[model samples]
Target: MSMENAIFLQKNVGFCNALKRICIEGFEYSTLYKRIEKMIADEEKKEEKNEKLLVDLWECNLLLSYQLDSKMLSICVPCLLKFALKKEEDEETPKEVEMALLSLSNIKFYRAEKELYLNEIKEIIRNHQEHHNLTRLAYQSAWQFLMNRSLVYRDLKGIVMNELHFAREVGKELEEFAKCVDWKKEKEEEMGKETKEKLVLMRWFHVLFIFFGLCNLWNEEFIGLVGGIAWVLRAAKENHKKISEKYIYLLGNAAKRRDVKVEGLLKIGVVDSVLEEIQQSTLNEGVTFQSCHFFLKISERLKEKTDNDELEEGNRKATKMEIFEKLEEEGYDDTITSYHEFLHLLKVNKIDFDAISLDISEYFVNV
Candidate 1:
């Protein structure tokens, strides 16, 4: 049916009621599928096109796909990806591309369909990696694709962390995310007012890196994140505590790896930021423990380097001493002591263990 007719039917009570009755009487969705196929074939002709039809068809597909599971969506995948990857033909992005990506993200895919189209989906994301209009939707689509598969395949988790180059992506996103925050701005202004898209991207980074840490995928390259991670942690600490804690837990997981150097993390300002988090008036035991766990891991790595022949003797001692002195100056000594005391309290039943809700270690092993 033409979109005009569809709109008319939607607006007319009698026509809508009649259509509903027919649908209830087991009208085959194949009719809609045939109409969609014809539209796509016509779209492929590359003649003058009805932009409204393209957008409406995609939006209609998305809405209907949600309300009723339809295999016809699989047929639309290639056309959707093509439209989503279309070059900018005008000043504004073609509305169909965004609609295509949004539709792709919402469609439920079986494992077989994902395997069939996964590489194409990944290519679509890479093609638009820098596109202002499409980048977020591209990743959102890919994220949804992998997320659905990861539920059953398990190994796709490693694919997202290892093969996806999320570290590089995070670097780019953080560079953009930094522009949204102004240190000179008042604390209240900076607290929770970050753009929703950037905030969502931050959470994505947290999850991606958590997998990165758990999978032991942090190479020297990824270990070099300087201010970005710490900025994300501190920026989210006040109003977005859940993500802040996730980042802390991610840092703990990363620190647990022997290859992740303490100095790099120190350069990232995580040490100071974590210490600041520990000293927050609203202390969270889980965050404190994870913070201490990070310190413990770094201290152990430093101690090992100090005791072993990994570094030249004098330099090793100096570096370890310098870091330790800095930690002491930051009151890390008191924080560690407090963390130990808190653990003791939990052990002795003085502090309720139930209050410590986030079990970060599980994320490490499960992934």
Candidate 2:
């Protein structure tokens, strides 16, 4: 057979194979891939005819084969839908219309995921305006790949949700980054807020790396860090005790109790309990407490000691039991494990924490 005829046959075969996969072997995705691969090999074995045609055929087949496994339910979805939609418009069959609708749904799902990604992009730029370019490209590339590859799958709900969640998560990080950089705008001092913020983010990234890095994402290293954040949170709570009481008051409760003063801090309410003993101090007046939702921690103060400010030279202890109980109450243990994993979050963005709550509230209320 002449090269032209052979090439035409191969193209027809490739198209037929793809069509069969979609129409007949709908459930047999594995078969579709195997068939495509085998056909490509057969086409490659034939004698060369038109170099350009061969390349085009090879590329088209390769693209199809590559797409067989590549899932692009979010990015390439729209294009796939457009192709199907146009076909439905031309052929005008009920089956074609149904397929077009199904493809439309697939595209919509991916578009939702892409929307999530776009939201994340905006957040990255808004937060990390300084280093925004770097992350921006990363996000763009991911989205572009999503668009370029046509790998729409039947099960894409999870993919879209994950993309959205990832965007939300990454946005917080980038916003923290932006805020951290903005803090140094006026200081003109060494180790400006930018540097410290970078350190904080890097530290969190380290935790992410450790979590994602190590074979065991669930390592003890994370717990320690979470413990440390808990400790800081504890201190931050104490610092903002007075103001927290004010907010607590706003919650409109019947619990107005008292406790012994530590470091000249006049305390109110019960100790080692969910009821916060408000200590009169400056920090409290500005920031809202993280414990507003009940600050969950695994550590317990093993005999609270009086430190003028910080919890130094104090015997505070944490065990898996205490941590687990507190986290269980808050329902975070199910989502996360290990102190390091938790602490790594704080290591990333020092904001959206108690300190930031204070600053943001203060910014709006006082500043």
Candidate 3:
């Protein structure tokens, strides 16, 4: 058989094999996982194949009797996205991928307490350590955690069950790789030692997490919110930092394309002020306009605290009728839309709004 045909048949065979092993009569994680990977790779191999592959993958997702390892596809999706971003020539697609990954950036599950998903594949690693067999079950567990909201495993305690039935199959090969390394030579090799130390230092924080996590490790669920937030924030911050002037211009252009708010802001004499504020904020020493959203979230509170005296008229709660009538007379569309877009862009861009020049975007735009 041709290699291509062989691969196709292999996928079907693997899927059927997986199906037979599933607790559910026809649940098959391997088949779905391979199918998804094949579809993506096939789409990459030939442009003509893109639509067909998308349809195939969608159908595979739908027809699968259960999610099975499809949940693993959630984690796998970002990996594919990363590869796509690197390989694809299209500009528009990366932004869509970015948004999709951001939305799926979270995986929350209840273990003993709760587990907030991070980039660490610790579960996989831990599985390898306990079970000699890295069977489909382990993969399914990881997959379920990623895709299924972990409802099945919810409220479970993670008492590292004794030696897994098949730990030798997976970890054995990995262990062989470790043995291949010459520890004496590796230690004597300055560059190798330095690199190892660097990696250790880099991952020190994760070590801290596992250490501290021991307290609630046996809890019904595990929520790694702090770790997850740190991972996400770091990723967003890194990606935003990679933005060039051209990229920002594109962003601003996109904002301009969202024209309803900009035009309305101008009509209300706030457009120039808001833009100027954003510009000044962006130019502030070591400041990013992305930070603007952070300030925006609490801007009203800050205004109340620090700018209270600025309101010489004194503070008084206006009746709904008064507030609405005033807003209507001034046209709330422009002000509301402009501010929302402004702050949203700021947050999306990961700017430190708190550190930027205050309200500069809102300043001259209003004039």
Candidate 4:
């Protein structure tokens, strides 16, 4: 047989052998584990056939199967992490590294012991951003690994927020995503598949940020960042209903934060975007509620900022007046009426409609 045919036959034989082993009555998972360990360790000596064998295992679901025992996951995770973190002289990311990241992503089960490798994965995320060696898919895989773990491991949430500095990193990424797609051009003209994909990624980032924000990971520092509330609101100008609704929801959540700087909201024409959402002909009840609440909360925040003596009196007065004017221009009374209507429809007892009206009127009083 020719060399190419010989290698193909050998690969098929190995796959068949693995399947046979899995079906055997006395098969021990440890046997499969040891085989994988050996293959990974002797990859160079085996002329890289081991990488192909690993890929076959993954494709056969032998490695990627979530039904596998938790013990098996614990074993595979460390092995995969070590392989992914291996140093190499090549400038390009090796296929081995990509495969390892892919496999790690599939191994979804997490344990306290896995916390040891969290820092290592964080390194991969950072290095990939700095060096551009890992493909985008691989880099995203690394993030998936962390996000999955963070969900199951509560301790990792704070680590991901404070240690990873996700606010800054996610902000930078969203900014880069914005640059890749001309939202104005897409709205006015036609978009290619790649641009569409970028928009999808943009939504994914927004969703991810919202998730973290609800987890109490976001803070005041986010206002001025590249991917902050203002940056997200910019998408509201486009007629993408899903994006508009989601960003408005996020804005409402941010408005509730006492620490968040209300000036950031007025400076970015946030009221205009909120008005655009409120006036959507097809706006849903949920979005309408959020938009009205956003106005109420911003007014409250402006009052808080004005009351605080830390800010310069002139700047505070100017900002508070500017926001009140925008609110009046955008029909704040009409929004409050809508909010009360929603309260009645939803039977929401947590909010005091009268108090909300009073708080909003406080802003207009000072103005």
Candidate 1 clash total? 0
Candidate 2 per-residue lDDT, tens place, 239-269, comes to: 3243234333322211111121121111112
Location of the lowest summed lDDT over 10 successive residues in candidate 1: 14-23
The segments of candidate 4 whose C-alpha lies over 4 angstroms from its true place after superposition are 1-49, 59-69, 82-109, 135-137, 182-203, 206-221, 224-229, 232-239, 268-290, 299-320, 344-367
lDDT of 1 by residue, 1-367 (tens): 9667883343343222321222232222558645755675587577786655665555454534432344545555555665666676775564445445555555443545564567776776566564555545345445554555555666665556566665656556554665565533534565545443444544365345534534544464375443556667776665456557767777776666766666667666777787777666564555655676777666666666444554655654665677778767765665555555666777798767556666432222110
List where candidate 2 sits over 4 angstroms from the true fold: 1-133, 136-217, 220-287, 292-367
Q: What local distance difference test score does each model get?
A: 0.56, 0.33, 0.34, 0.56
What is candidate 3's lDDT per residue for 1-367, written digit by digit as tens? Answer: 8645654564444344332322233444467456665666666578465543353343333234344343545434444333323333465544333322222222232232223342333444354455433332323233223333324442221322122212222223323423443444545665333332222222222222232322232111112222222222222222222212222222232222211122222233332222333333234322234323322322332233324554432321222234335344544435544666776798899998566665443422222
Model 4: lDDT to the true structure: 0.56
Candidate 1 deviant stretches above 4 angstroms = 1-79, 91-110, 113-115, 130-164, 181-195, 206-210, 213-215, 224-227, 234-243, 276-293, 296-309, 312-320, 341-367
Pick by TM-score: which candidate is best? 4
Rank the candidate models, highest lDDT first.
Answer: 1, 4, 3, 2
